[model samples]
Target: MELVLRSYCDLRLLLLLLGFSAGAVLSRPTDEGKEVWGYVTVHKDAHMFWWLYYATNPWKNFSELPLIMWLQGGPGGSSTGFGNFEEIGPLDSNLKPRNTTWLQSASLLFVDNPVGTGFSYVNTSDAYTKNLDMVASDMMVLLKTFFDSHTEFQTIPFYIFSESYGGKMAAGISLELHKAIQQGSIKCNFAGVALGDSWISPIDSVLSWGPYLYSMSLLDDQGLAEVSKVAEQVLDAVSEGHYQKATQLWGKAEMVIEQNTDGVNFYNILTKSTPTPAKESSLEFTQSHLVQLCQRHVRHLQQDALSQLMNGPIRKKLKIIPEDHSWGGQATNVFQNMEGDFMKPVISIVDELLEAGVNVTVYNGQLDLIVDTMGQEAWVRKLKWPELSKFNQLKRKALYSDPQSSETSAFVKSYKNLAFFWILRAGHMA
Candidate 1:
């Protein structure tokens, strides 16, 4: 009887092994899959924000792919604005929807972020109140919720990427996430972060405008001499202080190109006389593209932003607000009222991230006068990282519109790790 029992047990063990093998063989492929749509709660103040999240599994053969979280910069912009519109949206080049390629390779996440941005909305009219720290904290909570729901991703490598003002947001959030990990509040296998054409440091970025002007051939030795001779001399003599001088200097710099370029569209080079269209206008989405963008990300942007867009002066008249101000009413001054000091704390945050073994790369388009490449270089020099010698390698590279699109601009300088590249023809949208 004992011998018969041992044989039965061995047979049961073999059957179990076969079942496990079959289960492994029949599992799903990693890449080119459908995105999982979901919402995470933001419990910040008296109000709550239901933030939107688009998540996809990692691509084929790679079961444990890195998870990338993308932030669309603007003190208020939607990740869908660019991430889906241009980079890795669940669509093909023709804008026909498809869950394939890059989306499958990595677990990509794009959040509406902050209470005021994207489809994430708050109940009270007071939901618009925001600041960098508030955003970082809200994101932290959202990430926790994400991990709880997709516990399988708890051990996957994580990365954050952003552009424009999001560079600042990404930096702050990365620092905060590192802190949370250290404190045991959250767990992550955090990787490096990247930003392009980000408006991070004002002093460092402002200088990029000069080179941009020169790139356009708007500033020749003769033109510089001409400006210094009379126009600049007069402005310098009469300026009340540095603030006024800066304003005047920027105006003069703008004027230098205003006469040289087509003069019809001064702000955006891509727009030919008409206002620049969104990248996805070709796809012809049913809902007004703008409305869909706001709905998908920001729950609060009412009809006012649309009205302001229609009215010219109203758009320009919008004021920059403090970093922590509310966005309750019309978003007339949302973008205009920028808190200039937002990037002030980024230096310390970067330092903290590096200390915590996080890799950070800040790149800029040389043609973007708004967030100048020159400024980024100066900022990096100022950081004085002890391992600065590693950043000495520099090589040229080509910047492209998409993985499939033709090359758009040539980039200068490719470094070992911590690096910046100047995209010759791109602007703030780079």
Candidate 2:
């Protein structure tokens, strides 16, 4: 029997907002003149909630700043719940300003993605589909409508960034936006995409984890052998086109590693035997923070009143019986039956983007066991680009971190518009 470690195959590293210079910043809102939060009716009953964050510090031409739209991973997770509340949003748990918030430079838009994730909701259960195309199309509709309403942001340089499965959505969205731009359907700078320890290919990522665990000394000879044996079964399942089964079997090997390691946190083994699974955060605590932000920051925003800002109609349609407890994590089992959803050819997509002169960067935390650096490196190697061979030949140029846990805490190598950072001693946004 497969040990089935909790949420093993799902790895989400909250991505960094690009274009932030090392400039001093204040925590007040920059675009205080604009609407801070709103909902878009992506479908008849599916409403996606979005909160805008200006560069935390004051800037003269804040409207000219690049825009970054962020999504959280779960195939069903909420960017509002995780990315904004738990990870990189402007506020701390008590709704106080977080000194390290990424909004210090780049403006951010965090939406509870797909349909059912976060504050986003659909009227009917059947309205939910986890396929990339449907979600991407809805994203297009939402974005078009957003730009139409807020014409000022339409021409700004826009970026799509995601963690985990959001990265999957970002890929499809990027391609769609490219086409839309050519057709003159959208009027945005449409920069590129950044993925944080995202799940690119189930096959490549799954096959890589066991060997990485072995190298980390978490797997002994017997554990390594068992993992390898299970990996073969996973490979067969994938080749047979059993995507769901392949995902299950792929997770089995890591589950075995966990069993042998006495249930260490797959995210960061050093975190020690925390009974809570390594891949998840405490929903209660995370939600508490989210509620605080909504009440404190959003409630006091300018344009709309508190009731209007909270959006009772959308909330009512969402069928959220409770007040604020409604926001938290979600398991996207809808993906199990979706073909090609487990593994899209993101490698090829990255290549296409690079060829088209789009700046693309994919980075992984070194200590991230959920999406181990080894697995990320393996997949990056498989990227079929003209300069790929040359990229591989170059050593990872030494990198520094003021917060680095080690002397050589990170290293990066880049060619043209593509760069990958291997952060040392970091876990999947833990």
Candidate 3:
């Protein structure tokens, strides 16, 4: 594999050729593959880290494949760490080749966004973004710098794929990117965005929790009623413009859920629950509960092994990361800084993208408790896009990952620029 490491200090790109002797699977890259990682100063004292893996399609030229940029949720999640290793990069968390890696189809770019996520860092806490707008602005700066430096990718088809809060960022970024491309500020064939079990409409997801759980037989009528009561409080707090209070109530609702469902896993209901400590019930919600929950879901990303891998081996490999900056060290501050904006819905942003004829795809795992499929449908129904009605009327086509498999993998419905996929038996990570 050919790797290019970009230095943040001198802004120099150093190319390195490395050999790997891993066992090959079907369709894995056999010829030369290029990997590039670096930091772009997006704002004063704020640098965003991005890692790009060139498409491994030996049959075609590297520039011919589409580029898919991944954004992890948490408003602070390390896409380079979680999305790359855990989800769809070339390797798994164990450093083994991932069979389902997206590298076979498209080039992958994992970004540590919002200035304080993963390897991205801010010199001062004041530089952390307080809202998605700031996040989008920083992302725009990062993209501009990236395209300017790597002129070869300027005209390639580019797409953004995000999970949870990253979806919210992706929506805003896509709209802004579209506008920038139209204004001649950026040169690229920006294609579309895919929101995978995204926290686009927090209220919608919160409101649907009771019904979703009850339908799954995880909660009884009384349990549903209790969950509903707390959920309503969350909605009330959000409606009254008390966002911080709403965040708190959201936590209380989660506690109520834990009490009712015997500590069910919030990501995938079918998964075994890891019981929360009894003391956690009395914990204050000074921080956003959604952020806390996201942290828990992706906690392994910040734990010792992965932490050491990134901060030790990965950091040493990159060599551009500053000595003082630790991987995911500033993630908590990143979550805390965006608390007030946590509960706000980005549905209108989706509407704007749809109206602009940007391809907007929404996919939700049926088993996801946080950002459930019901909630996704609820919010999608509220879109003001003219083609939404037609989109809904269309029959969903079953999708199968394996041609020989009898079971359906997912179902999808699409019209014009909008599409929605219901992933089978998957969770928030889908």
Candidate 4:
């Protein structure tokens, strides 16, 4: 399914502040303070695009704020298009100022990662990344070039925030960036990573779908059985190291779910009447078709008004994007290239991050069905980190966005450098 990941260092506080003053500022979009956008050639024929918006909070200089790099999921989602305008960037899809934008708390940097997503471009299909390590290595080159040219941000704390598949990418990128920092190859205050409803363990999520849907009362016993059977096939494929088969099975399982639930939204079970599935007979389960099937799951995001804004006004404003490289033009290729790696789990990378003393925060929306809370907890419990036992023993603390409101917005539990937030009444993009 199409997944979107977001990052926040102190996300709880950020959410609280946004709740306190959402829509407090309303005006036409002005000059976003010291905006910077450009292309970074990370490989021989692969170029990645990044846009940075210096913090707008007037009392503090931008350098004093943390730099948040947002990575969007889909294995191909455009952070510049979806993550920026639709979520945390300074403007909304209509180009109006977004008062609750993340720029209120930190500098925002949106990168179209993996060379073939968003404004990023590849001259040849071979330049598309085949796996997470290649994605991380390319990102490392981008970061080095960015820091080398702008030494002012070198000492600033830099955080990687990702959602869905982006979270898997963030884990690899964060570990690589940490190693580069230690080796003095890249100079920066590398901080932590926040994974929001990530696809770190796709099989775990796929396996949980039947039970989660049944628990929500969306499926009958027969429907659950059908879903469970397909899910088991997926598990068997993954267990046998047949990842391509597993990816294909994953799509079949999604189609089974859609048929049973009458096109229930994968991102949020509470939402209904999602687009109907295309006929199975008309499709072949090739790598490209698998990616296309996943894309169809989130077709609303594929071609949207944000794409237009990015390609027209935003492209002209940057004045650097290759004219041939339309935003999200080659995203399907990006997803297709990652098909074999799609079902692989990155749970070990998270354990390594925790063992290395990196601050790792994971959050999930209560209503997110694609990467539901059950799956998130399942993979987290498998972590080999020594502090996991102590972490589990800690009681979750309730969080409220407003002091006067009696309603709880979320719950958080933490020990040492790891934390998890369970956000209530929110969906995948939360």
Q: Model 1 TM-score?
A: 0.64
Encode model 3's per-residue lDDT on 352-384: one tens digit a residue. 999999988888878889888999999999999
Cα lDDT tens digits, model 1, 1-430, are 0011112222222222112221233345544444454455567342222222233443243345557787766556656334443445565334466534334335677775555554444545555545677778888888877777777667777778777667888988888888887788887777777766665564454444444555666556665454344344324423433432343343343444344443312223433232223232123322243333333223322234432331333223323222343333223222222332332436667666666667777766544555666667766776656665556544555544243557444443434336455654545555
Residue 375 of model 2, lDDT score: 68
* Candidate number achieving the greatest TM-score relative to the actual structure: 4
- Cα lDDT for residue 76, model 2? 60
- Measured with C-alpha atoms, the lDDT of residue 389 in candidate 2 is 89
Give the least accurate 10-residue stretch of model 2, judged by summed lDDT: 1-10
Off by over 4 Å in 4: 1-12, 15-32, 273-275, 278-284, 297-299
Query: Which portions of model 2 miss their true places by more than 4 Å?
Result: 1-35, 272-325, 328-340, 343-345, 403-406
Q: What is the lDDT of candidate 2?
A: 0.62
On the 0 to 100 scale, the lDDT of residue 312 in model 3 is 79
State the C-alpha lDDT per candidate: 0.50, 0.62, 0.80, 0.82
Q: Which regions in candidate 3 have their CA more than 4 angstroms from the true location?
A: 1-31, 278-284, 287-300
lDDT ranking, high to low: 4, 3, 2, 1
